[model samples]
Target: MTDFTEYAKALRARIDIALNQVIPETPNSQLAEAMRYSLASGGKRIRPLLLFAGYRATAGQQEHPALEIAACALEAIHAYSLIHDDLPAMDDDALRRGRPTCHLAFDEALAILAGDALQTLAFELLADTPGLTDSTRVQLIRSLSRAAGMRGMVVGQAIDLAAVDTELNITRLEHMHRCKTGALIDASVTMGALIGGASDQQLNILARYSRSLGLAFQVHDDILDVTADTATLGKQQGADLARNKPTYVSLLGLSSAQARAYELYQEALTALAELDGDTELLQRIAHYVIERRH
Candidate 1:
């Protein structure tokens, strides 16, 4: 197997640099600091990495100015979601990425404002993406908006909140996760493919890949919550169980969850095999998703 560690690191460095450039520094503004804090707090940067991989697979370019903005915008949406998800009204977690969550580090109100600012900034970045046509920009904006809004992540969160302490069948659980976690992931790859000028057929294949991989991502997360510790996870361990949220592990047991993740991994690889161009990076990512420890 190819070691994608260095490849992932290089793409992550580019994404971090682009993120810093997109969000200006303002010491006087607490909101800016909060926004920057959450963005800078380290995670895997999986969504942006997927975007870069999709771009590389289709465009055959290692880097592009337009791809940078698109990746950063998607990450901003992700960062904003995390910020809100950790609020007192939401997950109410005290830690994230091994540091205090935005609400705890700053204040609740400021954290909320920071999330709001980042969300709008995401759209703004897409609206003014340099080198893309107006139609392309609009498409990107629309794609991200739907992924981040009611039709996607928002509704998913609503389902999660409602499902607390309630039983969810496998189909309902998958649907909930597809909306919450899978939608933006789907958007990430498709948006990258769009920018890279992928044909409709290629886009359809990628959708299949992303859909399966997205659910697998959440399944592995649920496994980690049970098997990993607080320091290792960078967040409260068992937070999902504490919230009484349904998970693959909760509903299907640990062994079955692992089985499900591997099944999805195979599906993702199957979809990737049907696509053209250098899909080595995307293939490696699918492997990483299923086998990741944290």
Candidate 2:
């Protein structure tokens, strides 16, 4: 049995290094600093870890350029989304990862530009990866674009903004999350599988696993919003309630939301079990998703 804590630590370290290396050197010092500020702001790095775990699940061991590029690219996308999500027009958050958000650390204009640069940089990294075939690169770019674009995260955000103080059922909530959070999460694993040469059946199974884990991740996030304090969560406690946002805890209540997260965790584990290769890391990740306080 691998020590998942140690594994995650090492994985995060590697990802941090890759992200630093890939961040472009801009002539404008403020732009560079703002970009680094948000990208380096510490978090769980779950998206990149999922990419690595998906690769490992497919028995991919040898070094390849696509792996790090894909991991860092997905992290970049995640970071950019957070930056934009914290803007006044969006979630209007002040804190992230226990620190001031990019907009607060810098100005609103710099934060917006930083997010824009990071989003474009993600695709640039994928397009410029050295070892992948053109077809693979195209697939990776197309997949990520869709996940980050209007069809996925953007649409989810639009729906979320529209849903504020409005009635929402579990199904609609799930659909929103599936686009907002789940799309990138699904892309992380699916891109890893593509890089690792996964068969159609393997891709399907991993998709199921990632989907379950993604929703579980959001469910636990909602749970933590009500149960955990700001220091523990690294963000405002009860922000959802304050904003009157729809969340699992809001719709299903704390107990049912917690139970639903557990159920999704089981579904993720079952999906991982269908994979032929080692899935211990992914299973651990599923548990981490529901169990993490922040």
Candidate 3:
């Protein structure tokens, strides 16, 4: 039983500093403020944490500059996704991380622009990452772009939007989530492994671990929608149900959804066990993903 709480806290602090350095205050105060507002709004920072864990799992020694940039870039992408996801055209969320949503805190147009800026900034960070070989940088950029672009998160969002009020089977729902949330997560692990110079076999094993963990992450989220309160969840409780969204809980019932989360948790751990290096952190993250309240 590794204490992942302390590991997460330490890595999160490092990631926070990196993010602040990468997204410094600029001349354009409003856009900067909106960008900082959403980026700084505290969430789990799970993606970056997973990235670091992947690095560790590959026997990465020091905190490479490229690894830091990759972690920050992933967080930037995730923050941008949240900004757009909360827009009026999307989930129309009024709350995020226990505070007003970006669109409500700032204006809608600004929020949209802020998301756009963050998305571009993410790429810029990847492109300008220092000390990495050009090939490594290209691989990181390509993986991240695919994860964030039409083939990944965007298509997932499109599927989710279209599936609203429409019946979706468990397989279709899983596929949607794999594209939507899982792609980015898989990229995080892959990017970290690439930075650490993981072998192809190690990368494949990590991919399996990340994929299972990603779905478990979403499954737990669905469970929390029905189980946790607004303040506890840092957003509206039952918002998914209110929107008639197809969640694991909605499709499989709460008990079944919980069971499925545990199943995925085991699957992730199993994959991680196949990898060489200190994988305790990744294993603990799998546990955290399934057991998290929000």
Top candidate by TM-score: 2
**How high is the CA lDDT of each candidate model?**
0.90, 0.90, 0.90
Poorly placed runs, candidate 1 (over 4 Å): 25-28
How many clashes does each candidate structure show, in the order listed? 0, 0, 0
lDDT of 1 by residue, 1-294 (tens): 246998788778878877877786656578888899998776898998898788878889656678888988999999999999899888899999999999999999999999998999999889888888898888889889999999999999889889989999999999999999999999999888888888889989999999999999999999999999999999999999998999999999999999999999999999999988888888899999988888
Query: Tens-digit lDDT track for model 2 on 1-294?
Result: 458999899888988887888777778989989998898777899988888888888855665667888998998899999999999989999999899999999999999999999999999999988888899899899989999999889999999999999989999999999999999999998898888888999999999999999899889989999999999988899998999999999899899999999999999998987899878878888988988878
Cα TM-score per model? 0.97, 0.98, 0.97
- Cα error, candidate 3, residue 32 (Å): 0.5
Positional deviation of 94 in candidate 2, in angstroms? 0.7
User: Which window of ten consecutive residues has the lowest lDDT sum in model 1?
Assistant: 20-29
Q: Candidate 3 on 1-294: residue-level lDDT in tens?
A: 346798788778888877777776678899998998888777898999888888889965567767778888999999999999999999999999999999999899999999999999999998998988899899999999999999899999999999989999999999999999999999999998898889999999999999998899889998999999999999999998999999998899999999999999999988987887888878888888887878
